[model samples]
Target: MDDRSEGVIEPLPIRRLQESLINRIAAGEIIHRPASALKELLENCLDAGATSIRVTVKDGGLKLLQIQDNGCGIRRADLPILAERFTTSKLSTFSDLTRITTYGFRGEALASMSHVAHLSVVTKTKTETCAWKAHYLDGVLVAPKPGQTVEPKPCAGNDGTTIIIEDLFYNTPTRLSALRSPSEEYARILDVITKYAVHNPKVAFAGSPLPDLSTSSSSETSHAIRLLYGHSIAKDLLHSTFSSKKQDEAMEEESEVDDRESWKAEAHFTNANYQSKKMIFLLFINHRLVESSRMKRALEAVYSGVLPKGASPFIYLSLQINPRDVDVNVHPTKKEVHFLNEDGITDQISDTLQQALASQSHSRVFEYQTLLTGGIAEPEQSISKKRKGKERARDGDEDEDMENAETKTAASPPLKKTASQYKVRTSLQDRTLESMFPVINPTQIEGSSSGKGKPADISKSREIKESECYLTSVKTLRQNAIKGKHKQLTEILEKHTFVGIVDLNKCLSLIQHSTKLYLVNHGALAEELFYQLGLRQFGCFSRMKLQPPPPLRTLIEIAVELEETTAESGLTKPQIVDRIVETLVARREMLSEYFSFNITPTGLLESLPLLLRDYTPNLDKLPGLLMRLGPQVDWNSEKECFETFLRELAYFYVPGPLCSANPETEDQEAQDKAEKWQIQHVVFPALRRYVVAPKTLLDRDVVQIASLPDLYKVFERC
Candidate 1:
């Protein structure tokens, strides 16, 4: 007590209680949560150039925390000052903070964390043959059990640093109660990893709610996340390059990175899309993981126009900069910082993104969907028929959710059935490498009927003209059939000799042809061949135009439709009077885009547009050309469909520049001559524009045939 109480006031001696109280308050600021402490310790390990990092947590970090890194370790001589306040090997003075390069420089994380928790460090540097270890409490070395040395002891360890924190805020009830459940905390931990993982793809980062996966209980397997979740997590990163650059703004003394910045980072978030719904994108301006609501909002905004509505994305951005511009003193925990030029950076990021998307001219996210009809290689007709029947029965011929559909049961029960009744679901050809990728869904196909026509038999389904296709397999198939006493496999093959088919519902029967498989569809199959064009790639569909005397690409699309789809069924006949009206009505816009199109209208296609009417040529063909609405796209409420109709089919088909294999060179030539083919013919005029409450995404079938392996077995072993 240095206080003197006489006539004048005198200074009092500093009380020990006051010093202890101040230390505890400071502890609250630095070690806000288990994650905060973990982050700080992790950064220190990384700054040491550690190749591997391991983290373990318990009871949402109320019980224990541990982190080990294979980086430079503290020396035994430094152990006494290891947990002391204001002691660090990073920066020595105030000016050093400006050009700071390492992750930690304030020298407060260790001291502050030590004040509220039991802390320990087991470390070994390359200089000493032996390792060193220490323990601390209230930022000071503690005597082990009352009589042990407070200094480090020689111990065995690798060249690394290991930190442990236990009973965080043991004396603070409010802080302990404020922590979330173990599972919830783990989610937050994974969330943090996801952001960092996206940014630091080369750094292998792994963490588990349990200490180790091998030691996890069987019950824990029930909660085992998808492989995508773990990969997207910052656990097993390798090397990755990012073309991210920062721009400075002299105005307002602010600098920002706009979306215009070109970036091609192969991140875990992109791969994680296959496993998890929440996809993440990371940006590292430098090394610090700063929070930029602008970056986050930009990501969400870009995704808003692309992904299904109502879905959000996850991201973590790390910006490395000299510490001077960053005010690390802003937050007690220091998990966040105030950057000097946040606004400037946001603008650059957003601008870069806008340019990137605009440059991708043909994104192909939307296309027609329909199964092609084709003969499969070595068709096991009886067995395949049986399996198909079982598949239909199990699915109940209705749309279902894909998520709830895939179960993770280790083994499925066996079914009891006679051998004669069994069948294999997939063919040997289907197990090929190319088949491993999922097949795109085909669009609905419309038959040549203005009204909903009745189901037809083999003969009626063959609605084509003899002049169009002399190669109808149906006309020549019966002769190849063999008459045998037993059910002959040859007989079945002879009946359906085409290689593959893309039907209305988008089904495919791929055929084996040497190492490569051929998908023989009646339409578009001939047009899908690879042809090199400028930077834009043009497949099967021809991109060139022909007018003076000969036409090439249009004839190919026309010929293939008759050859594949209706080898048994004939092609639709052209309509007469009404057809002329369609072509004559519209001609202007088609000339500018220089694209080809055809229409098979059902009603008065001729009345709708003169340009379309001209293509039909026959009175009956007019009805066939009238638009018909089949199933909606069900993904975008058919917006793309409507856009396609307006942009491509509104005008009559005028052959544009015949798309040569060289599209880049041909594009220039074709554009100059585009005026020659404008409004020549309507490509697919029968697609109706109006709809009543088009199907929402929820209304979609969401069918994932491969998702139900067990259920598929019923069909496989029919």
Candidate 2:
């Protein structure tokens, strides 16, 4: 006890860490690995408004890392403290942090690199006659060599910025040791660049000394993905655009600024046909490449139902959220970010993706019963022979006996099984009184002849029965569609009550049931109603006669030109055009009777359907509509023809884009308001009268408002 008291009498004194050591520690936090460091540097180039960014790396950027950008360069006056911590042109005050629009705002990337490595910059402003070169060590200017002046020197260079970093993490041996192999680091580097390339397809990326993995600046996102990823992933991609404007108005009203509350998300994802060993997720928030584990997991859950047990999908999403809603400083490296309503946004995006995948699956064409063809029979016979040989060996049968049995079977004529034999072999029973009747052979019937009389009568009966069955199936399917409509109507009438309009511009009306409010898409409702009305009023449509009765040849020519432009395999442009023209001409009378179109024999003038007199469609779309009808309509089936025709007509009745000219006078504003009021009062009432509620819209119950609670939850965040 005496020895302990003598040894531990004094406490160790506290002291400030040396600047070099402090800077090195901070640097280690920001640049954890080669990929993270490369991400920071790339962001800097984008922030500079560079159209093209070139990167060069040696030994996975541990030995040397360089980036050059053709953007606004650093001025000579700012060169001395260029690498200083907390220095940036993007932010002027602490308040700016709340709304950071730039990629690199904290000004830590360069400063951190300088502490762990030797940093140099060569920059020249557009107005500057000579470029200025500078060297930095630990956030301050230093000489390139010993005994040289510790100041920037004049040099010749392009009107841009060039940054060079050497010996990265040299002062932190532990961090250097923690890094992966150079090849692995290089792969990570490429992954980061590829994601950014997708986000900013207008920007070109080039690698020096390494493979020139560059993308064309003019390419679109799809093309860039094809170039970087591969054709396999690109071919199976499904695209969807989601916006917050699609949400209930009550949710959006909670935000102080309406415009700021609205956000848009675009996703390009692989369908069920495409799979990978691991999920390749590239997410960008406001064009800044970032990661969100919550988003990744949510998206993976969506694919879990679509893909095989051990497979995943490729997803690239770009989200544009208001600056104030996003906290970019949550992580030191800014590799991840926290945004307002993270859970709500993620759920919405995941739901949208799932809906897209479901739709894609529904559109797939399956080849059923193809194995019944002769081409498949050969393989089946071979497999059966192999199985029989194995069975004989297992049973210890002699090969000679097996050969003799096969030869006997081959020599004998094949036996035709009678109807009684078929009935005895099958377990299925007709559960009706008809099952009690004995099977009668057609050849043995009363009017039977030795040759053709009974056989001809049996063939005629079978054909008549098949035709009846086919017609019955068609009738059943149509009845099912009608039943579905009736079921939706019953649910809506029983469960929901009409509420006031929320947004007439978007045709969104709020309806409440119990404590929840649902946003109804009146636009979609109107389209469905118009289609139903057309079907009900077939062959008696009201006509909107053209003033001068335009030449039908003109419409035919337009269709021909469109067909030529979008021609597909197995059909020549001229052949498609000729077929379309001939088909329309042949069906002219039928079109006139059913659709109220009046055309002359020599291809002249037609009247269109007068759906809603107040709503005028964009006449410019008429030719394209006719062109699609030629190919999309099923001419072979009467049911499909009617359904497709009604759908096209409904599409034609939908409203077009509003004029965007400035409404400078009160009269113009009043007229706009009056139009919206008319839509709400006249159009919506008429639509509700005819339109039955749909089972689903965008993977959600159309009339029930099942997700109304989720909408309320989103507003709570606001």
Evaluated with TM-score, which candidate comes out highest? 2
lDDT (tens digit, per residue) of candidate 1 on 152-203: 7677766678898888888788887888787777666655554444344444
TM-score of each: 0.45, 0.50
lDDT of candidate 1 at residue 476, scale 0 to 100: 29
Estimate the lDDT of model 1: 0.44
Backbone N/Cα/C clashes per model:
124, 0
Residue 534 accuracy (lDDT) in model 2 = 66
RMSD of each: 27.0, 24.3
Q: Model 2 off-target regions past 4 Å?
A: 1-10, 247-257, 362-718
Global lDDT for candidate 2?
Answer: 0.69
- lDDT of every model, 2 decimals: 0.44, 0.69
Question: What stretches of model 1 exceed 4 Å from their correct place?
Answer: 1-17, 207-283, 314-325, 361-718
